[model samples]
Target: MPATVIVNARWINEARQTAGGLRLENGRIATWVNDRMGWNGEQLAGMPKGPRLESDR
Candidate 1:
């Protein structure tokens, strides 16, 4: 289980542009964007069990 989830990250590094969600479990990255997509109002009914943090944009 993740303690926090960050969605729609537009992080840019020297290598490439990174985007998408990141799930942190136990102070570490447990899940990446490739594993799960951003959450939406439609998915609220059956949301995953965890605390998620998302941006307005």
Candidate 2:
């Protein structure tokens, strides 16, 4: 699975001066952490019914 990285932001309960980061996998949140809080993915599932990507145009 491919992974995406995000930076330069605060997560959870934290002061405005704090910063945090996150990682995403399979279009779901994988992990999130900051100077004050942290979290990880438990389960991620896609919608059973949704618009097709090809029809987005």
Candidate 3:
């Protein structure tokens, strides 16, 4: 899976969770930076490399 970064993300549900950025590694969430308005955002690193697509399929 490709490393991902989502900004100003919100969740609409019973928990009503929110995050400044959600990170994913190996197709699963690796970390979540909680909601903070006016935030400059965050950096996620040290992600494990995923299987190369050319061989994965």
Candidate 4:
């Protein structure tokens, strides 16, 4: 499976971990990306790209 970059992902908690993106690989989370836009506002590592997605809490 190819790695996926989930942008516009916000983790609201005491830790305040603003996980810009999540790198998913092999059916699991591979790593955390600090850049929400996915590497200089563009896709990197050959991950499929998509528009920013957000949800109300």
lDDT of each: 0.29, 0.25, 0.24, 0.30
**Each prediction's number of clashing residue pairs:** 0, 0, 0, 0
Give stretches of model 3 more than 4 Å off: 1-18, 23-36, 43-57
lDDT of 4 by residue, 16-38 (tens): 22222334332233233323333
Q: Estimate each model's TM-score.
A: 0.19, 0.14, 0.15, 0.15
Worst 10 residues of 1 by lDDT: 9-18
Model 1 lDDT tens row, 1-57: 232223222222111112222233222332343234354323422433333333223
**Model 1 spans with C-alpha error above 4 angstroms:** 1-39, 55-57
Best by TM-score: 1
lDDT by residue (1-57, candidate 3, tens digit) is 323311112112111222222333322333322222211223222212222223212
List all candidate RMSDs to the true structure.
13.3, 15.2, 14.3, 12.8
lDDT of 2 by residue, 1-57 (tens): 122211212111222212222233332323332211232322212222232223222
Candidate 3 yields a Cα-based lDDT of 0.24
Of the pair 3 and 4, which is ahead by lDDT?
Answer: 4
Give me candidate 2's TM-score against the actual structure.
Answer: 0.14
TM-score head-to-head 1 vs 2, winner:
1
TM-score of 3: 0.15
Candidate 4 has a TM-score of: 0.15
